[model samples]
Target: MSASPGQNLFRQPRAVFAVAFACVVSFMGIGLVDPILPALATNLNATPSQVSLLFTSYLLVTAVAMLFTGWIASRIGAKATLITGLAFIVVFAALAGLSGSIDGIVGFRAGWGLGNAMFIATSLAVIVASATGGFAGAIVLYEAALGLGIAAGPLIGGLLGDISWRGPFFGVAVLMAIALLATVVLVEPLPKPAVPTPLSAPIKALRHRSLLTMGVTALLYNWGFFTMLGYAPYPMELDATQLGFVFFAWGLLLAFFSITGAPWLQRKFGTAPSLYGALSLFAVLILIIGLFTGNRWTVIVCVIASGVVAGINNTLTTQAVMLVSPVERPVASAAYGFVRFIGGGLAPYAAGKMVDHWNMHVPFVVGAVAVLIGVAVLTTGHRPLAAADAAMAAGDRHTDPDEVAGEVADEFGGAPDAIDFEKELDHR
Candidate 1:
């Protein structure tokens, strides 16, 4: 019999734990710099727009690098990709800490993004392949690590930023190095893809209706997500520690909802209704923040509240993309990552520029509208998402094809069974 989800969580292998630990640290990089943005501006003698480019550079590189992740992984294999990505992050994060100027830090961050793309794209596939209790269990574990990382990032940033603006960067370097060591030691190497994925694969994957639909929706959703994440710190005008605590609260709600709340909601309301309600609620929250940008208490409350919906959206949207797409999981992830990261990368810089020129309120107002646009985009994918939901309900989710093929090859001590391969690929 299949293991229960609760039991599956504990039954994971050492390799799973190693990679999951790395996932937690990798995700922390997303929010690790939040507590230090204001500090960076002060110490580096930069404007908000300049500091915001830190995100722009990092995400832009990550977005572009995602296109090649599938190609590289298919050639070099998963373990090499994971280690290379981690090494890049460790080196660049430390370099970012050592930089003397904002421009220097931004340059290093871009390098960090390239590594991030490789790691993020491959890590999901790894977890999906390695975890037990089926796809749902793996997703829960992945989302949980994401939550913990996101939640801890700002707290770590806050504590360290109290020492210096550079402290958080160095902290990520140290922690990620440890994660890299764990991954190298614990995670067993996997066989290379039997058929190499072309470099054009991720780009081609976007032609699929379900992948494109979810990718575009995530693009729109990210505009709102990053607008709040990138700019909210400025309006609050709190010190590093206070800003850390506030976002820590936000990240906690994000973590809780992602791991526990999202699955519950998906089972109860189904994917479509759950996403619609959550995105709508999130758009409204953004509107409130826009309307009350000048009110510190109101901004803080709205920012924290946004986490609940954001958390739900994060988990549900990821699950939706994986389920609905017909492409290999890694390719789907890369294609989806390419679109959303572009939006995520662009939004913060845009928000910063908007704040620089127009007003703080304008960015949030625009963000609210963008999120509502995501709601509309999601509507276009109703058919595919419905089918995916039905598959989940029927316990018919597809396993990772590369993993299935590897297992078949091991069992037969030669080429995989073509029938078995086709069955796994077409399972959904």
Candidate 2:
């Protein structure tokens, strides 16, 4: 008898939910703090730039933590790391809620960021490990959940922040507890044990030219993306519900496309062209957003339009980055995550400074420039990644982990200390 068509998806539904809730919880903590920045500044008797550090503090720790969490995931196992991270998050969030002073919140925010680093880094690796056909479907699912989490953050945060600045953090802490329990009980352990690769391997991979470019691309995209998100509502004087609607549209659009639009585009244009097109359109969308500010209908339309491009851009960029270093995907992803978060970390400071010194639109202009820079990098450094992916794909036998490992080792050349081909080969 034939198996059900969607069996693979259900195979690890519980694990998926655990990770998805983690995504939602971590992001809720972030968004909850965001809308209240102005309030936080007033309450704490701080400058806007100082209040913005709440974001910078969290993202900075998360970025630094990502550098090692991927290595830790390999050693401890993805599932275990995920549970630990969520527990840390739950504890830290509750502490953050109880903070009596700005310095207290900053300290707890850094701790929260550290927990985020653990959660996000392991979450991606776990998804990839759980999937049947590598990360193809898993990426889409991850992105969809990411969109939902990001989309919900503003509305939920706004509501809670209005009631009390501390309310959102407490509410998110409650969510984190539930997530922690789900992560502990619901997710199945990996069938195969996680193979430990040496720490030096990831360090070496980070030095690769292709991976460096990918990191740069990620940083630029995030700089632009977060700048837009971090400061958009404030300049326009949007209420919490309106901000929620914007995020809702953003999530809904990405969910629709990730499930549908991306596949069709990939089928038609192939990865490279689709990638370039998505990046190009992303740049244009940034311009459109800057141009159409203050009109609710236009803002909603532009925000939603940007989601399709973002969904496609993320999936394709991840694929492109992975293609260049198939064996080192986890490490590469961590590096990319680090770069993206670094950019994200600085965004609030940069955008807030801009809004404080110049005007709100200044940040959007700067964001547009950042997106354009990413497009330029992607367009310029097109060859190495493409050539590498083609070389590996030629020898890789689809769905065969052994063949995939062999192909990757051969393409990247055998580096025992760097790759530990034996470890990868055995995992197959």
Candidate 3:
């Protein structure tokens, strides 16, 4: 069948913009809070480790919560979940603004993380379902927005922190409210997913060799990413404004790569090659930063290089998973996100201990090794999605007509009471 005209534009442009805008707002909140961590620690008379919990706790919950969000959205509908999640962020951000102590802030951050989990899971699914063409551009756009948000967080957070540590939290509350409104006014409800696979189904998919390996790869990268992003400025003894500049540079490099480099790299090199290359480069960059810590120029160069690597590597890794199982993209995204968070949660605490017992450089070395391992994991025996796509096409060409028909029916919401997947599996 011929594809519908203008379908590509209709599916992605509108919904993707809305989702990206929502992410921008929520991520801005996250970014804004980051630069204020030290101030908050001092203000609350808490240890640096305790204040760092602000990032760790939020990510931890969001990571765990994301695993279930896909199934929940399928049951409740994406629009409802999106709206409700934004509400959590908006309300809790305000609550965070009111916090007078470290514990209060940590609690609020965790609550906001729950909202983020909902937003991330629902937004991702909606974007994929709403997108018409292949997902390379769409994924890049999503990652770009994320990078922009991360970049903006420190700058804005620094500005607000200059006034008061409480200031950024208040701004976060306001931005989230604005995003909530935008989502309602600009974004349309996504078509409900046709087949709501059981939670067990995703678990089963995870057992697939490729999926399991990618999950581990994602976890290790997240551990490295959160470690680097979370701690890059701490040992430099930089003020908030200086740190903000560094973050801005980092985000700018990421956005540049996300917007420009990603498409070209994916197109020229193919997803797996681009992904593996990016991973290798990122590992090297992290090590460079750690090893040359005393050389200011080299450190700055390494930071920018790291941003480029992160943008390309992350986008391609996600693309790899989606290529293999387009239908399971949401579940896979959530599962990968969950693993990433588990890794993220562990990194800070582990790195914090190292910072206490050894030296700050210790975490950087560990993080570098972790990224290298991720590269190996992602590249080892990795059957590229292109190969998978080709094999499927060949399979379709060779398969019996009845089998193909049944596969189509099963995939796209077959006629009510018309097909049994169990029967089809038995036939296979």
Candidate whose lDDT is highest:
1
lDDT of each: 0.86, 0.69, 0.70
Worst 10 residues of 1 by lDDT: 412-421
Ranking by TM-score: 1, 2, 3
C-alpha root-mean-square deviation, each candidate: 5.4, 3.8, 5.7
Clashing pairs in 1: none
TM-score of 1: 0.92
Model 2: weakest 10-residue lDDT segment is: 396-405
With a 3 Å backbone cut-off (N, CA, C), the pairs that clash in candidate 3 are 31-153, 32-153
Whichever of 1 and 3 has more TM-score, that candidate is 1
TM-score for each predicted model, relative to the true structure: 0.92, 0.85, 0.85
